[model samples]
Target: MTHKAIAFFDLDGTLLDDKSQVRPEIKVAMTQLKENNVLPVIATGRTEVEVAAIMKEANIDSDIIMNGAFIRVDGTVIFSDLYDKNLIEEVYSAARENNDAISFYNEKEIWCNEHNKFLLGAYNFIHTPVPPVNPDGYLTKPVNMLLILGQDNDNYYASKFPQLNFYRNTPFSLDTVKKTVSKGIAVKILQEKLGLTKVPSYAFGDGPNDLALFEACDIKIAMGNAVASLKEQADFITKKNTEGGIVHALKHFELI
Candidate 1:
C-alpha cells in the first residue's frame, strides 16, 4: 500500500529516550501514524542486528541502518553497501597507532579488535554490551560500518582518509562509512526504490549526524535537547524527548 507520507526518526535522542528505551507515548504515536497512512522509518547509525528488538517493540519494519550502508523496506532488504577490506585494514592500523579501539559491523554481528575503555563506554552509552573480540572478522565477513572508539581525532581520520565519512554521534566513538554515503543519500534511494518520490517526508533528529537526514526531508523537526547545530537547521522544534517530543511533533503536524 502506498503511504500518504513518510517520517524518518533518529534512534538516540529523537525516538528513544536517554536510557535507550522507546517511550510509551511514542509507541502509541507510531500506531496513530500508521493508522493515518504515514509510514515511520528508522534512520540511524545502528546496525540491523542491534535494532532488531527495538524494531519489534516499536512495530517498525523499515530502516536505514549503518549510517545508510544498509536499507530495508517493509521487511525486505533493498540496499547494502559494504566497505573495502583494504580500507578497513588501513583504518584499523591508524586506530592502532592512536591507541584507539576499532569495531567491525555487519548486518548480523559486531566484532572489535580490542576491548578498551572507549569500546566499553560506547556500548554502555547505548545500553549494549561490548562486541566480542575478532580482529580479523573484516577479512572474512562483509563490513558495512566501522566504529572507531575515540574522543578526538575525527578530523585527523577525515583528512588522512579522504575517501571515508566520519560522524561522531557520541563522545566515545566515530561512526565511519564510505565517502558519498549518508542518511540523505539513503533517504533518496529509499524514496526512489519505494516509489515515494511524491510523498511528503518528515525527519526527526537530535545530532550532527542527522544533518544529512534533515537535508533530505521536506520538513525537519529537532528535539529540544538536540544539538544546537541541528536545531538551527530544523523547521520545527519540539519538546525534549523525555517530555513527549515525538508525540508533540506528530500532533503539531496533525499526523497522529
Candidate 2:
C-alpha cells in the first residue's frame, strides 16, 4: 500500500459479520481504500493462521494477529512476540489446579486434554482446530493467551499467577496472557512498522479484552451491543454487531 497513513481494523466484531464472513460494504470500502494506497491492517486477537486465511478469504493483503503476537504485512513479518516458556508451564499448571476447564493458544495450535469432552466441544463452537498435544497436555510452543472456563475459582488464578494478564469475557470464560501484550500494544507496533504517523487511530471492538486497545488509540468506538463498560469508554457508539456496527463506526470516522 505504501501510503501516508493506514487504518487498523479488528476482524471479529469490526470487519467480519456475525456469520464470520466479510460483509459486502466492508469488502467494497476496504478494496477502494487499498486502491487509494491507504493500507487496511487487520489487528485482532486471532493468530497468524486464522487471520491469514481470513485475509485471503477477504482478498486483503496485510494483518497483525494473536493480539499482536504474530504480525505480517503482505508477505513480511513486521514483528511477533512469543510467550515466555517458563510462564507457559506455570500458567498451565495453575489452570490445571482448577480442574480441566482451560485451553491454550500460541500462534499455531489450540490445545486441550482429551478428557474434557465438553470443553472440546467449545472448540467446535468457533470452528477453529484443536490438535492433540504430545502428552495430551500443554502445547509445545508457549501460548500467547489462556482461556479458562469456570466461575467460583475466579480469584484463584489471579492470586497465584499475579504476573500474568487475566480477565473475564463471561462468567464461564477467563482470558489470561503475559502482561505486556494486547491488541492496543499491537496497534502501535504495527503503526510504527508501517511508518504511519496518524494520531488517534480508529479502533472498534466489543469485549473487555479490547480495553487496552480502546484506551491506547486516539479514537475508540464500542459496538452498541458491547459490554457495559466498553460502551461507556467508547468515543462513539454505533449499531449492533449483527447490524454491521463496525461499518457504521467506520463511516462515522470517514474511513468507510
- Which prediction has the highest TM-score against the true structure? 1
The residue pairs found clashing in candidate 1 are none
Per-prediction tally of clashes? 0, 1
lDDT of each: 0.92, 0.68
Runs of candidate 2 exceeding 4 Å displacement = 115-118, 136-142, 149-151, 170-172
**Model 1: lowest-lDDT 10 consecutive positions:** 22-31
> What digit string (tens of lDDT, one per residue) describes model 1 on residues 1-256?
8699999999999899889997777778888888898999999999988899888888788999999999999889999999888898899999999999999998889999999999999999999877999888788899999999998888899999999989998889999999878999999999999899999999999998999999999999999999999999999999998899989999999998
Backbone clashes counted, model 1: 0
Candidate 2 clash pair list: 200-218
Q: Put down candidate 2 lDDT per residue, 1-256, tens digits, no spaces.
A: 3574466776665577766677777777778766766677787766665565778766678776766566777878777677676776776676678674666666666665443654555445445565454433454556666666566676787788777667664445566766777777777787777666574466677877778878767778888777888888988988987797866776776764
* TM-score for each predicted model, relative to the true structure: 0.98, 0.85
